[model samples]
Target: MLTPLVDPDGAPFWEYAAQGELRVQACAGPDCGELRFPPRPCCPHCRSFDSEWRRMSGRGRIWSYVVPHPPLLPAYAAQAPYNAVVVELLDAPRIRLVGNVVAAPDAPLNSVDPARLRIGAGVKVAFTLLDDITVPRWLLERT
Candidate 1:
């Protein structure tokens, strides 16, 4: 199974997801409160080391998506046709996250049909335990 590489800077993200909460790291600098995904050790905006993990509303839209054909990593080949999505948070549109869109929180990566995905489609955060890490997945929001 392909797993995420949890580094010290990004550990908190996985920790929050494991607890069923979606959180993003934000710079705590006085003049720069930039929200960043794929957490980093220092703030890119103000180059500040100070930061905080802020809970998200779990609302977002599909900014982009892809269904890999063949030539995928060996571990992911079995889950071919899975939709990988880039979701732009409603509150922080600048911060986008990469994840798979599933039918339910615990569903497999192929649960959602690839043809059903669309850019600009609304989605919400969902967490699932994959291997030893809890990762965030996306679910299409119903009208």
Candidate 2:
């Protein structure tokens, strides 16, 4: 599996995942609490430099997905035919995260059958440690 480069702005997200918590960065401005992803130093909503990590429910629905074809990079070729999904968070509808829908937290990317995936299907967050970082994956709500 490929590891994500941890930048200062997104360090907190990885830290929370390591503790089994899914959180999103939000503006800490007194009157503005807009959430933002790709954690940045400033808020696009209120132009605030202050920010905080807000705990999320980790529930979402598949908003979109695509099953990749062959000719993938070596690092991902082994996981070919797997689906990459865009999940829309339940609590924060506007916030969508990109990941794979797997059968288990540590399961391989192709663990879930491609035929089983569908847009609008409910999913819950599952975490798996990749190297020193714990990353979040999604599992079907029913199975």
Candidate 3:
């Protein structure tokens, strides 16, 4: 599996995930309370350098997704039919995160059947440690 390159601004996010906490970066500006993804040093809304990591509910809906076919990265080729999804957070609708939906936190990439996936489906965050890094994945919510 390919691990994410942790940068300074996004390090805290991975740190929180390691502790089993889901969090998003938010502008800490007094007048601007907006959430931002792909964590940055400055808030795009208020143009303020002040920022904080806000805990999230870890629930979301599948905004968009794709099932990659073979002829991809060597590492992911075995999981060719796996799904890569963009999940819109329930609490912060505008903030969407990318992850794979799996049957369980530590399940294989293709653990969930592709036929069961649907747009707008409810999902919750799940974490698994890979090569010492805890990464977030998703699990379909029972209707």
Candidate 4:
């Protein structure tokens, strides 16, 4: 029961992730160089259509996090107290993405104990299949 964060746009980014690749949108225009996520057809900076997909290293630090403690939808009530984290990718410093981490695809959202989740912790990408989409999750990396 994997729900995808998808849209009419940004489909390609998910497609690549499904293949176990992390990619970002980059500007191909001269001078207005920049990279971004949540893909757009043109550069947000210079509005350039000359953009391409570039792979990322997929390592990041925890920017912020919250542990949800309540009446989660009835379906998820059993998995209450889960931590959702906003991770700032080292490859894309200014941008961040949110996800959960687990040892397996079917692992509960609350699988990563709060005691183990912290701001500034080093994390690496992990993938879990929610139906057909392979969503990116995260895991604390050992020193």
Candidate 5:
């Protein structure tokens, strides 16, 4: 299993996921109100320092995606080919997020056929508890 990489800014997100909730950063700044993804200390728009963690609907479409070729990083060599997708959350228009789409956390890339994935395919976020972090994964969303 590949241990997820986490940072200080993303800690709150994972912490909330551990509680079975999906949270994303939202700018509370008055001037430049916007939703930030991957979590940030300030709004990328106005550079405002005010921000807060807000829950998301966890529903999005596969705007774009890619299947990594063989000989990936040492950590993902076995997972040679897997989907890394950019999902546009329905709840936040400008807020798009990127992550993997695995059948299950423990399964490898080979677990899900790459050809089966398509652009604009609807997907819903799912979290698998790994230790204390809730890494976002995706599953096919019914139309």
Candidate 6:
């Protein structure tokens, strides 16, 4: 299984996730208020060092996805057909996150059917505690 390596810039992300909250790093520049993922120390838009963690609505759409045939990671061999999805946040379409879609907040990677996923399908964020780190996952929204 994969694990997240928390760094100074990304520590807040994990802290929020542990509390079951979804947040994104946003540039605090007055003229360049932009939201970014994979939290960074400097704003890519304005080169500003000031930033803040903003809570997200946890709503987004599937921008892309894939089901690895030959599991690349040996730990994932047992979950061969699991999916890795790219989701674009509803409020920030330019910001996308990669994760798996499960039936519930804490379900397994393969809990959701691969065939059921579709581009533009609505999804909501969910947190799962893995190895003491709470990671964000996705769940398909019921139409």
What is the C-alpha local distance difference test score of each model?
0.90, 0.93, 0.93, 0.79, 0.78, 0.92
Q: State the lDDT at 43 in candidate 3.
A: 88
* Most accurate candidate by lDDT: 3
Cα lDDT tens digits, model 5, 1-143, are 45667889888888887776778888888866677876879788888989888898888888888887764567777666777889888888677888877776555555667777888888888888655566778887752
| Tens digits of per-residue lDDT for model 2, 1-143 | 77889999999999999999999999999899999998999999889999999999999999999998872667888787798899999999989999999999999998999999999999999999988889999999976
List pairs with backbone clashes in candidate 3: none
| Residue 19 alpha-carbon offset, candidate 6, angstroms | 1.0
Error of 4 at 115 (Å): 1.2
lDDT of 6 by residue, 1-143 (tens): 68999999999999999999989999998888799888999998899999988889999999999999888888998876899999999988898999999999778898898999999999999999998899999999973
Sort the candidates on TM-score, descending order: 3, 6, 2, 1, 4, 5
Question: Candidate 1, 126: how far from true, in Å?
Answer: 0.6
Put down candidate 1 lDDT per residue, 1-143, tens digits, no spaces: 57899999999998999999999999999989899877998998899999999999999999999898872777777777788889999989998999989999888788888888999999999898888899899999973
Candidate 4 whole-model C-alpha lDDT, 0 to 1 = 0.79
TM-score of each: 0.94, 0.96, 0.97, 0.89, 0.83, 0.96
Report the candidate with higher lDDT, 1 versus 4.
Answer: 1
Ranking, lDDT, top scorer first: 3, 2, 6, 1, 4, 5
Query: Which stretches of model 5 miss by more than 4 angstroms?
Result: none
- How many clashes (backbone N, Cα, C below 3 Å) per candidate? 0, 0, 0, 0, 0, 0
Least accurate 10 contiguous residues by lDDT in model 4: 101-110
lDDT of 3 by residue, 1-143 (tens): 88999999999999999999999999999899899999999989889999989999999999999888872688987776799999999999999999999999999999888888999999999999999999999999973
Q: What is the C-alpha lDDT profile of model 4 across 31-66, one tens digit per residue?
A: 976987767777889888988788889999999988
Against the true structure, candidate 6 has what lDDT? 0.92
